[model samples]
Target chain A: MTSMDFLLLTKGPLFQIAIAIFALGMLVRLVEIFALGRPHNYAAARGGQLIPGLKTVYKRFNPDPGTFKRAPFDVIVGIIWHIGFVVALLLFIPHIELIKSMFGVTWPGLPNPVVDAVTAITLFALLATLIHRLTHPVKKFLSTPEDYLIWTVTFLPVLTGYLAYHRLINPYPLALGLHILAAEIFLIVLPFTKLTHIFTAFVARWYNGAIFGRKGVQS
Target chain B: MTEFSLERGLNALREEMDAPVASFFSSCVHCGLCATACPFYVETGDPKYTPIHKLEPMRLLWEQEYTLWGKLKSKLGLGKQVTDEMLEEWEPLLYDSCSMCGRCSMVCPVGNDIHYMIRKAREGMVASGHAPEGLIAASVRAVNTGSPMGLQWKTLDVQIKHVETATDLEVPIDKQGADYLVLLSSMEIINFPEYLEAITKIFDHAGVSWTLSQQCFEATNAGIQIGSKDIAATLVQRVVDAAESLGVKNVISPECGHAYTAIRWEGPNAIKRAYPFKVFHIIEVLDQLRAAGRIKTEGKEMDRLSMHDPCNLARKSGVIQQQRSLMDLVADNFVDLEEHGKFQWCCGAGGGVSSNERAEELKMAAFKRKKAQIEQVEPERMVTMCATCRTQLEEGLEEFNMDIPVVGLTEMIADHLVERDKPDDAAAKAGG
Candidate 1:
């Protein structure tokens, strides 16, 4: 067949395989969540009361209520790190482009300069996190091959997408194809590995906060 | 209930489960930061005994099973070695050794609860008949009879009567429809009646519609400490049912740390259902009265009061901050001990070790740790939120032989009972 038809065949098979793998990963995660249920025996956490006074958590967590104020750095970093990661995962231009191509829907795009700046921040965070995993003894000890695999998978898509944008690799289609493959692989792995932490962590934090919150305590 | 030759059986269980727990164990990176948070580690200066170190065998297993290189190393028997002897040695090193304070989790960068891991290990060992004779017996007594002391019904009757006589306040026996049902740890009634006296005075001073049921009164649930979840559930259910029968709006837990945690945190699981009534630690109730103007303080004198954090309450149950804040409300001398809140040091008496045969040695080491903490601030009294801590601290303090009082929040509240100084002669004569 012609070069265009060859490219067309490649896209169809890759997309099909990616979707199948993503579905399998999601199925495995469901088994783990329900089958390996933890002991959620927190009673005070389950009820809500119209408490008139200060909450129990503030009394227990900080003791001194005045010490509860957040530092500006905490507010800024906590917001920036959480929001930036979420948006990058959902709205990163190239990833969004892949979504549009797969589903035949599209959205407005970011300016090129803004895209460049955000991609840099994502890469910077990836590198810093990798360094922490390697250097911090606790993280290093607790981490496994799956952990490193998740990290490697994250870096690949961003690196390839950035190269594809600048045409740094000369051939645009080859680079773009590999970038899509990387994104697909990352998605399949996301729900299976410690990458699933994104869901479990909020569950843990909110549960902890809610328990103390019901008692009129800061969680 | 499960019995075995303490030393040998412990080894065998540790042997059969060596690969699993030891392999799962490599998750901790001992930075010695956990030491500052653990009373035993801080007092003994022993790295091997820190809460994280208790997971060393499990870490050995984690290395063998989960990691790429560690699995490769295990092929040649090169990963952290696990043996029956190693498991045998870890009995004291893991169970009798650590208090399961949960403070280590607060300082852990990952919030890894090494103490929970230790307790889980002990449970596996206990299932295989590895638990100490003393602990096993107590667990047996609790499951069979309702108290750790194995107090007979007749004996509890005498104790209840004495409590009523001493405090001149009615300590209800199996009463129904009380506004509050006060649950006491067997430890308080059997070992320290002075605590009962204090609790009675608070009930009387506040004029709260409350009662104490002789049945279902043992607040100490050894099931929790021994990791026997079913037994803990059974023990907690009795009290839950009693409170429901009393129809109280709240069930006030005495100054026992694990008791508060068991009833408040594990109550739902224990009963397999929820009770509508609230469960409050005695400190929580006292704090409420002080805030509501039910009980007024005269001097606010204890403002410089330095408090010791009981492990089960502070870290596991998450009441240390509330206990401290309530103390701040009552005293002007509320000097916060440095390691306060989730970051505070353990009382070193929890995890069923309070009644252990080795309790004296463990209590001594734990006291040394707490004494140094107390000396830093040197407050007038070391206030506590748990009855077990009060007992252990009092037990530990005899070594120092200092005159500093060890008072529970309830006892402190009893001291501040401000009932509008009645015109002495007139009030005495009226007797209204």
Candidate 2:
């Protein structure tokens, strides 16, 4: 197919299919998780859990001081990439326009230059994470093939978006088409991989906090 | 009865699967931050000791049984099965290296509750006949003899007599209608008879009516450490039966960390019923007495004192502030370790690690983390609330040739109790 045709294919039917798979896959996964059903705790609680549970959902955004000291590189890089990724995803005009078109809602986007800078920093941070995983003993040992696969799927969209915005590829349509295609792949694979953490992390945090909080712990 | 096998282990793991476990497994990003929080990994610098990695078999089972993609993979023979061999290899990882300290659960960036998963994983290990021999023995002893250490009630009765003679106070036995029914760990009865004396003096001074149940004095639950809920429930039911028969208002878990968690937190759940009597750690009771102006003390300890918060007590049970409050009552020169309260390093022998003889070297290796924390503070004496933690601290410090003596917080509080006439008068005065 020509670059224009490829661009149209990615932005049209392919995008629709990707969104369907992403949404349905995520729903099924979430159902599988919640449907397992935690056992009812018969023990009396030491304190209220609701507020603490909600608090942890937000509190885990920052690592505790001791944890940060122990794994400073991971914590810092993790925070940078996450913030950068979110900023690039939501604050960039093109992404926001796409989101607005899909969901019928729009927010003011950041200036293109700022988004571009963030995208670059995010790309570097993602690369740093991969290198760290390959080197850090615990992370290297814990990582599986799926980890690298997920990392690639996660990294590609940002890398492709940055390249497309810069028109680094000879044909602009081809670059743009690749960027959209990369994002579609990300969406399709997300619910099947560790990338599902995007949704489940909050649930995990709430459960952890609630469990500990019931015992009057602040965790 | 069916013997333990890989199928049984797999079935146990399937039973252990719950929403929290599912959510935790789904959320793990493999960032390995849990290793930083784990004493085993932190001290040994071994990736194998990574807390999440220790739960790999369980995680695999979870994936294969729970998720659609994983189910598909398993049907196609592409998914990994938890084998008897895997359980054998992981025995050291699950039992030896892990204290179930929950520090890893505390620090997981994604909030995986890695230690919680490890606890559930042990159920499978036990069913597979892969549990450490020491733990298996302890569980057997706990079930048969009523104490993991195989101590009988007569052993505790002897300690009770010694405490009565030393303190010149009546050690009430199975006193019906007492305010609290006290439970003791075998470690306390065997190693620290003074714990009985301290509680005797404190109870007398506070005018709190308490008794020791001859029916079930032991509090430590090996079933919990060995990861067997049926055994845990049996142990818990003994305490429940004893407390109900005595009609005590509350049950006090002695200076034992896991014992406190087992009876106070996990007890009701294990038996699948709400407890008629409430449970409190000794420190929590002491703090309550202190708050109620029931515990009056005259002298403060002059030595430089610091505390090691037991993981089950501080991190798991949220009895953090109670110990600190009790410390402030009698400690004139208290200095907290750099990491104290919920963040305190474990003494490296909790959750049956101390019971497992094969884990001796790994247990001491894990002690290095606590040793480093203790070195930074250089306290003249270390105090803690849990019997297991206290024993580990004393042993660990001595092994490292650190002269910091370990003391139980309850005993320290007892040593400072003010001499007063008619303990009942003191209570009446406080009441008025």
Candidate 3:
């Protein structure tokens, strides 16, 4: 198929399928997790749990002092990529326009230069994390095939999106089409793969904080 | 004897799965941050000891039995099957190498409770009969006898006689409606009989109404250490029954880490009921006495001193400040360790590691972290509240040829108790 035809297909039925699967799969998985339900704590609580649970969802954004000292590179690079990804997704003009088209809401977008810088830095951070996983013995041991697969899918969209915006790798339509397709793959696999952590991480933190917090622990 | 099987192990993992476990497995980013926090991983540089990695069996079970993709993979024979051999290999990682200190849980970027998962993973380990012989034996003795060390009431009665003779005070036994019901660990009875004497003098001077139950004096729970709720509940029920019979207002957990956690935290959950009476660690009780002006001390220790916060007492139970408060009253030269209180290093012998013979070398190796922390402060002596930590501290310090002495905080407080001017001052202290 021509790049135009590929673009049309990704933008049409493929995109819908990806969105549908992403949404439905996330709903089902989340329901399953919550449905399992927390075991009733018969022990008397030492402190307020709800506040701590809510507090930890934000507190985890910064690594603790011990963790920071031991894994500074991971912490710094992780923060960069997360911030970059968020910026690229929510603040870039093209993404903003796409959201506007779908949801009929509009917001201010970052300038092209700013978006370009973030995308480049994000892609670099992702590559650095990949290299770290390959080289670090502990990380190498902990990593599974799914870890690498999720990294690839999560990384490609930014690469293709950046290439298309800069008009470097191929024709604009072809690069843009590949970027959309890569993103669709990411969306489709997110709920099924280790990437589900995107939604579950906060929930996990909340529960942890609640459990330990009720016991008056700062965990 | 209970038969061991792979099916039993897998079923235990399945049974332990709940909301927290489900979310923890779902949310682990595999960033390896937990490894950096774990003393075993940090000291040994072994990836297998990584907190999250130690739960691989449980994670695999969760995936295969719970997740759709994992089900599909299993059907196609692509999923990793949790086997007997795998559980056997993991037995050391689950019990010996981990202290359940909850440091990994604190450091998780995704807030996964890696330590809690380890505790749950051990349920499967014990069910599979892959648990260490030492811990299994301890648990069996705990259930069969009243103590994990197989100590009978006669042994404690002898110690009680010794304490009464040493202090010239009666060690109250089975006093109805007493304010406090004190418990003891085998370590305390065997190694530090001085603890009983210390509490006797302090309570006498402070005029605190307390009693020791001949029926249930042992506070340490092998069930918690061995990771069996059924056994833990049985052990806790003994104390509950005794306390209720005596009608005590508060039960004091001895200077033992797992004892405090097993009784104060896990006890109610195990028995499936809220305790009729409140539980207090010895340090908390002392702190409360100090706060209420019931405890009066005349002087502070002049030697350079530091504290070793037992993981269960400080991190798990929030008894950090209470100990420090009591310390401030009596330890003038006290300096805090670099990682004191909630972030203190384990003495490498908690969570049943001390009971497991094979874990001895690894436990000593893990103690190097605490050794280094101690060296940083350069204290002449170390004071701690937990018997397990105190025993580890004494042995570990002796091994390293450090001349530092380890003292129980309760004993230290007792050493500084102000002498009452009149016989009736004891009554006035209690009244005031």
Candidate 4:
């Protein structure tokens, strides 16, 4: 297919299919987790759980002092990439416009230059994490094939989008088509891989908080 | 009894597959931050000691049985099964290296309770006949002889008599309607008879009615360390039965971390019923007495003192402030380790590691983390509330040739207690 035809295919039916699989897959995974159903704590609680559970959902974004001191680079780069990725995905004008087209909703977007700088920084941070994962002994040992695979799928959308936006690739349609295809692939693979952490991290944090909170700890 | 096998182990893991475990495994991103939080990995620099990696067998079983992708893979013969051999290889990882300290759980960016998973994973290890022999023997002794160390009530009775003679105070036994029913660990009975004396003096001074039961004086639960709920429940039921029969208002867990965790937190859940009375760690009780203006003290210890927070007590049970409050009551120069309270490094002897003879070298290796923390502070003496932590601290410091002595917070508090007047002096002074 020509570049224009390829762009049309990605933005039209392929995007819808990708979104469907992404949503349904994540739903099933969440159901599987929740259906397991934690047993009721028969022991008396020393503190309230609901507030602590909610607190931990937000608190875990920042690393504890010991953890940060132990692995400063990992914590700093992890925070930077996460914040940069979200900003680039949601605050860029074209992405917001795409979302508006898909869901009939729109929000004000950041200036193109600002979004561009964030995407570049995010790409660098992702690369740094990948290198760390490959070199850090514990991370290297813990990593599986899925870890590298997930990292690539996560990295490609940002890398290709930045390239397409700057028109670094030769043909505009070809670069744009590649970017959209990369994002669609990301969505399809996300719920199936460790990337499910995007949603389940909150659940995990809540459980951790509730368990410790019942014992009057702010974990 | 049926012999332990891989099938039983897999079944046990299946039983442990609850929502928290599922969420924790799903949320993990293999960042290996848990290793940084674990003392075993921090001290030995071994990637194999990573907290999440230690739960590999249980995690594999969870994936194969619970998830769609894992099920599909298993059906196609592409899934990894938890084999007996795999569990055998993992015994040290699960039992020797881990103290169930929960620091990893605290530092996991995604909030995976890695220590909780380790505790559950041990259930599988024991069922598969892969548990360390020391832990198995301890569990057996605890179940049969009522103490993991195989000490009898007569052993504790002798300590009680010694404490009564030393302090010249009554040592109440099976005193019905007492305010507190005290439990003791075998470590305290054998290694630190002074614990009984300190409590006796403090109780007498505070006018608190307390007694020790002849039936179930032992508080440490081997089942808890061995990761067997059935055994844990049986041990817990013994304490429950003893307390109920005595009709005490509360049960006091002695200066042992796992004992406090066992009876105070896990006891009710293990037996599937709420406790008729309450449970408190000795520090918590002392703190309460201090707060209520019941226990009066006259002096502060001048030594440069620091504390070792027990994992089960500080991190797991949230008894952090109680020990600190008790310390403040008697310690004038108390310095905290760089890492204390819920984030403190474990003494490396908890969760049955001290019981497992094979884990001796590993336990010392883990103690290096705590040793480093102590070296940073350079305290003259280290104080702690848990008996197991105290023992480990004493042994580890001696092993390293550190001059810092270890003391129990309770005993220290007892030493500083204001001496009360005799009945004759009180009456004569009132008349004058």
Candidate 5:
């Protein structure tokens, strides 16, 4: 088979399989949250009604929204970091083309240089957070193998893609090919690790604000 | 005032936390979202004043003495030891700034329980003897003399005499078998007499048999505020013993925020079990009485009623619903503050702010959030469920030079009672 034919057959099938894996992983994650949030009858009474179920969430719920909201900076930084991350993820041409091919759709495109630069900056910014996690003594307890691995795995494709785009190596095709593979793996891994936080953060925050507001917690 | 000795004492206290509960304290992510909910953070605009930052001393101690990685950091001077000099920073940051209101913990995404975290930090401060001398003196008085103000029995009698003169209603005293044993904090008897008078006015109007005990009255519990659990429990034990000895069926907590917490929540736990007698915050009592149509009140003329829930009775306790229930009776226009419940802003006086003289500026600054919230109402009066809140808000409004009256939840209830006859002034105004 010609190189293009091999690329079409091998990369195309691998990508589809990777897509299925991503969907399944997401399903498992949603199931886990659904199980946790099934609304057990026991979580009804709150410690204080003024904050509207806030007391109960503290006493009864496993992770209270009120408790986590204390560090607004971490929340704000985490959000800015994640928004840039998702936009970078969707705009990468190979992944976007792959997604379009699977779904039989297309969206307007970004210039190659612009997309690569964004991918490099965002992934590096996330990499900096990872390095800070490993080094900061205060953050040491919060650090886990998963924390390091997830960010490293997330950055791999961006790193490889940046290397390919920058024309740093002789075999640009090989680097780009490896980058495509890593992107496939990362796309599949999104729902399984800390990335689940991306989907959960909004649901958690808005749900909390609404519930507490109605209970007349927020005047 | 900052003390040199307190500096050393604070270091000693930090050492204790390092030895025992450092694991619990060091665990936090500094997300600034909690600042939006914190009155202290709002007033100071200092990230360190936010609830998450309140744990920094403890976090520093944890790093220096515990966790292998922290121990490594300590060796490199990256992690500063909790030395005598550090107390200079920790004292005002922890005591003056924090109200122990638990609002940050309420909003925390990780369920950090910043209240307990702050309390643990305070435990370090308390053990170091870094707490306000007045609080220590008063709590010691409470331990030895059975009250915080250290009032003599004769003075207690004089106050009862005053209550008689004001209401023409007798408070059951040292009498066994009364239907209710009404508890007052030292603030009510020693500072504000009208709160006790309000209780009497309601009891007279409702015909409930209530009595004051010369043996056990004042309910202020500094132990809880300062994070000394033992002293907190002792504060509760006094009320439990008095009620048990007097054979009272119900224990009514005065409007003091910390006092209500000591009695209603920690009091039962302090007694090594729950008491058979029901614990009712004054607002809860008024609410039930109003709902049953047992008490009559003359509603205030103000159209807009903004009720601020004291953290103790509202966020700290679950009786915030009663604030609204009572508010429903007080005015035609009731605007709920959005950041109101467990989310409600503290009057900055709830966690022993009234007694900490050094905390006066912090208290006033903390009250700025509540004051701002009320200013939005453009109301005739602001109603609150705590005596300390009334005190804090009243003084806070004056400090900011705003002309709003701060009244108690019970006072509002009494005003809105149906049995209240329209004043003669109403008739004169009608004729005019």
Candidate 6:
């Protein structure tokens, strides 16, 4: 296929299909969870639930001291990567234009240099995570093949996006096409893999806090 | 009798896949933070005891039953099947090593309640007949004799006579329309009769009207420890029936952590109704009494003292501050363990681990965490509320050859009540 045709394919039908699957899969999974429906807690609340529930969603951004002390490397890298990924992916000028065309949403993009710095730092964080997983016995023990696969998918979109932005791999269209394809794959697998934690983490934290909060214990 | 089979275990697990369970399984990021949070993993450095890994069988069952891709993978024979052998292998991981302390739950970055999942996984273990024999026997005895230790009210009656003789106080029994219905665990009845005397003196001094039911006095729920709701409900029903019959306004759970949890938190849910009377852990009630100027103490415990917070009471039920409040009342030199209160480490004998003889070594190993925390404080005495925790603390300290005396907080408070001319006058003064 010509470079133009390959670029068109990655940017056209593949992108649409990936977004469709991502949206549909997330909706169905969330619906399935809600459909199961938690039983109403019959006990009287010792402390109001709503405030603590909200607090937990906010509080987990800064972990408790004990947890931080135990898993400093993981916690630090995890927070950095999450912030970097969001800033790099959503605030880059090209990605904003893509979102504007698809969803009719508009937002100012970060400057190109700022985006480049975040993208580089986030890639390093991803590599550090992979190294930690391989070398840390507990991480290695808990990881399944699916864990590594999800990591690879999540890592590639940023790596290839950065490559395409710089045009470091010869033939700019081919490099850009590879970036789009990697992103499409990442989106397609998001709901099915542990990447779903990106969405479920808030709800899980809220529930954990609510349960403990009702007992008058802060999470 | 139905035979234990893989199908039965799988069905039990599938039935437990509620909203929280589904979200928890989906949201776990495999960060291994839970391992660091777990005393078993942290103490032993064994990856197998990682809190999430202990629930692998349940996770497999969730995958097979709930997920579309999991179904496809199973169809293609790429998925792991939860076999009977797997359940057998995981029994020790689920019951023996785990104390259900919930430190892992608190530390989970994605907010998965690993402790709750472990509780759910126990249902399958029990259904599959892979539960420890000690737990099964305890459950059976709890149902048959109304106490897991198989002690009848007759045993408590004998202890009551001793308490009466020692305190020169009447231990009220089955008194209708009393303000509170007090329950005792078998551990208290056998091992610590001073708890009965302590309450009698304190309640008399406080002018509190309380009664012990001849019909239902045991507070400990073996069914909970064994992870059987039906059996737990049956045990809980006895207390509900006694409380409703007595028309008490409250039920005071004794100084046992799981007993407090079973009655105050899990009991109403198990029976599917809000209780007619509220429940309070002994420490909570004591704190309330102290807040209201009901309890008056005359002396302080003259030593450098620290506390051991039971997991179920402090972490699970929010009884952390209440105990500390009461501690502040009677102890002049009160210092806390570095990790006391809601963040306190488990005594390593909760959630039926103490009952399972096979878990003794692991339980002691887990105690090293608490031991180290205590050593950091280096207190002359250690005070705690839960009887199970007290027993574990005593045994653990004895094992380590530590001379620190572990005293029940209730008994400690009782030891310092202001003297009065008569019990009647004391009651009248408290009432006035």
DockQ list for all candidates: 0.08, 0.87, 0.80, 0.86, 0.08, 0.75
Best by DockQ: 2
lDDT of 5 by residue, B155-193 (tens): 778887886765555667877888888888766666567
TM-score of chain A of each: 0.68, 0.98, 0.97, 0.98, 0.70, 0.97
Off by over 4 Å in 4: B424-432
Q: What does candidate 3's lDDT look like per residue over A32-85, in tens digits?
A: 689889777788789888998988888899887777888999999999999999
True contacts kept of 3: 0.74
How do the predictions measure up, each by TM-score?
Answer: 0.69, 0.98, 0.98, 0.98, 0.69, 0.97
Off-target runs (Cα >4 Å) in candidate 5 are: A1-77, A80-219, B1-27, B63-78, B297-303, B416-432
- For residues A1-219, what per-residue lDDT tens digits would candidate 6 score against the true structure? 977789999989998899999999998778767777787677777887888888887888888888898899988999999999999889999999988998899899999999999999999999999999998999899998889999999899999989988888668888999999999999999988888888888888887888789988888
| Candidate 2 chain A, run of 10 with poorest lDDT | A47-56
Clashing pairs in 4: B255-B387
Runs of candidate 3 with Cα error greater than 4 angstroms are: B424-432
Residues B268-337, model 4: lDDT tens digits: 8889999999999999999999999999998789989999999999999999988888888999999999
Tell me the TM-score that candidate 3 gets on chain A alone: 0.97
lDDT of 6 by residue, B347-417 (tens): 89999999999999999989999999999999999999899899999999999999999999999988888
Q: How good is the docking of model 2, by CAPRI class? A: high
Cand. 6: chain B TM-score: 0.96
Q: Write the per-residue lDDT of candidate 1 for residues B356-425, one digit (tens) a residue.
A: 7866587578778677778889887888877778877787776688667777776666666654443543
TM-score of chain B of each: 0.83, 0.96, 0.97, 0.97, 0.85, 0.96
| Per-model lDDT | 0.63, 0.90, 0.89, 0.90, 0.65, 0.88
Candidate 5 CAPRI grade: incorrect
Candidate closest to the true structure, highest lDDT: 4
Query: What lDDT does candidate 1 reach at residue B313?
Result: 66
lDDT per residue (tens digit) for residues B264-346 in model 3: 98999899999999999889889988999999998889999999999998888888899889989998898999887777888
